[model samples]
Target: MNKITTNAFHPMQLKISQADIGYKEILISGADAQLQSGEVCLLIGNNGVGKTTLIRSVLHQIAILRGTITLGDKNIQELSVKEIAEYIAVVLSKSAIPQNYTVNDLVSLGKYIHYPFYFELSKEDQKEVRETIENLGLQQYDATPLKNLSDGNLQKAFIGRALTQNSPVIILDEPTTHLDEKNKIIILKTLRKLAREHHKLILFSSHDWRLAKEFADKIWYIKDRTLHAGMVEDVLIRHHELTDPSLFNVNEYFKAPHIIAPPLYKEMLYSLLQKNSTADLSHLSFEFMDNRWHIDAKGNGYQCGSFEEILVLVKTLH
Candidate 1:
């Protein structure tokens, strides 16, 4: 067995070559990607675009049709399941936890890689588990049953377990799936911290474009048989396919509201235009000093909370 480095600051990378990724047929082909240590990359795509398939291929759960995946100094195909566990920790999208299990129970189970079949957890392991639970804000639910917990809290518990596992690489499939706005930010922020502060490789699939775009250092967009990757700003600006907004005839259809929002609301503005299907967003202008939105328009802007409120605002604008 080859000795692996324990240094967190070491240059660790996951490289993928031209591979066909999917089940039965290729959903994406000739894909290439790489992630270095201390980088947080978000994978974004619509449904059935093989995002999960690519993830499975990296985890070695699914066979690569034709390609190579190298992790650090070793090829992924050459590593055993146990050996791979030493390098990566994964938070699954739909794992079934036992209804009877407690938050602590689930987290303690992460140590089974080191102490398989041992019912007792070592003091060091217990300490790590406690710290992970506390860090994820799961301490209050430490004794709560899995069945009784909210979906967001349950998701956090799963994340805490993955953190306690202590692997250099972490992959999460929609870690913020059931989480509300606040909890979603918490998880994404934690992932970024893990990558930068702890030198962990963080890769995750996310549907919350705003949250992902806000926190991710880079983006890996899977679309049209390609995996586009780069710094978030570069990817957003360079890749037209990822930014192709939904065309809406809002001005011709419904009552369109005037929006004096910041320029960063590109995606949101596009969506609002489509949702209202009556406003023209192409002529929309915005300004922001920092991340906060401030529109520099000639009219008194009416802040709307929903699409219905937008209709009323449009009437007042006229």
Candidate 2:
């Protein structure tokens, strides 16, 4: 029996070192991840970081070079593809819809998993399909041909299809790739609600750090050929250890008068503030240290090197 770690939360889902990818050597060696019920996990890394590969590996659509994945105490390898479908639903980067398929037809296909060989739709399935369409605000497009719909509408239809599957876990790969800002927020907010209100596990990969930090309960950061997993704040702050100074430029740009550090550095500064618990960061302005590349807080044109210093200044106030 595999001894579960104390840190392991009740797994809504799990992906162990399974790699079914074509590469002879593992693209991601010894990768292990777990998602708790009702939690949203965000997978983030630069392009070609094996996010899709890992997803496929977990689903057993591809064979693992080594290792095992378990979902809710059941080994993934032991489950048939159809059995896995009952627990895990996926929305891929691209969902191909037949040219003649209507939004309602596409969403209705999700029920095929539960149907017998004849695949007759029951009243319950039809009700679920309809509810999914309305929940995603896709009622207006229900009769529209998928090929004729806009990218945003089409994406929502894809999500509606996944919801109709009624699985406990939904995995998406770069879901916001082609979406505009408004649609992106809508999709993300919808996923967050699904996790919180419906008690589903929602895992998605994205390049949007700001949105991920704001919405995700946990973050999986892949860098320098390794995976680090933790709360979003912890992973972001620990990113400094993996920074490649030569490959990327690091600079502080002023958003208003306050210096806005890059995501990684900003998280680091926030971690420092949290450690000291002194300075009320809600009021301080941020500036960058030109020489050391550290972010510092400033107020009334006075620089505070650390959170403790900021606290002393705050004490002097009033």
Candidate 3:
């Protein structure tokens, strides 16, 4: 086993080339990407599309069938588990929570890599743990039991533990699992801050691409047994389904109504109007004014109090 320095604070890059990742059979092939420190990358794919397999391969928990994964100057396979731990800190979504452990206790475990659990933490390590908790906005809940905390706070506590690890690279598998929109925003914002301000390389897997892409610098998209790595916008624009799955189901026969409303209401009206077909496909305009929908069908105007009423009117028009 080779020993590597644990505290070198230089810019690090993770590179993958022509890799095949999976267990018995290859799940994802031709995987290639380069991710640098100070960047937040999002790993996106449908369920069971080897997102986790690729992450595990990078962590060297599973061996790549072919090609190479290099972190900085060293190949991942050549690094020992402990050495890899020094480089990467991970938070798995389904990792078991210690039943009776306090938030402070769980977060302090991150320092065990540097200081053994049996020994008292040096003052510097203690301060680091405290700062990590405070940075996570978990200072008030530091002494609270893990079971007592909400899922959002518990997820942040787990992230606090990762922050305390002080590794250059941080990987999270579904960090926003089961979190509401507010918590999801909070978690992603925290990751963006860590990557931009702290210069930590962050790779996180998520199904929430609509929201997650806004915070990501790069995207590692697993599709059709290939890994596509590029700027988030570039990748999303190249793959239309990532932006809107409904594009696949566009009805050639359906005539869309001219909807004038807020973007949100306009999109909703377009979606709802798609399901109904009018016999007279003449000019139809639906305008939202004063919180009500004003409809004009071939110069005949009707006011709709609600979406249901609008649909009922559509039926009458048909």
* Local distance difference test, candidate 1: 0.77
- The numbered model that scores best in TM-score is 3
Q: Please write out the lDDT profile of model 1 over residues 136-213, one tens digit for every residue.
A: 888999999999999999999888878888788999998999998888888888888998899899999986555556
TM-score to true structure, per model: 0.81, 0.72, 0.82
Q: Which of the predicted structures, 1 or 3, would earn the higher lDDT when compared with the native? A: 3
Q: Candidate 2: deviation at residue 140, Å?
A: 1.4
CA-lDDT, candidates in order:
0.77, 0.72, 0.85
The candidate 2 region of ten consecutive residues with least summed lDDT is 249-258
lDDT of 3 by residue, 130-218 (tens): 98888777899989999999988999889888888888899999988878877688778888988988888999999867754589999
Q: Which regions of candidate 1 fall more than 4 Å away from where they truly are?
A: 2-10, 240-261, 264-318
Among these predictions, the greatest lDDT belongs to 3
Q: Model 2 segments beyond 4 Å from truth?
A: 1-11, 15-22, 117-120, 240-318
By summed lDDT, which 10 consecutive residues of candidate 3 come out lowest? 1-10
Better of 2 and 3 by TM-score: 3
Total clashes, candidate 2?
A: 0
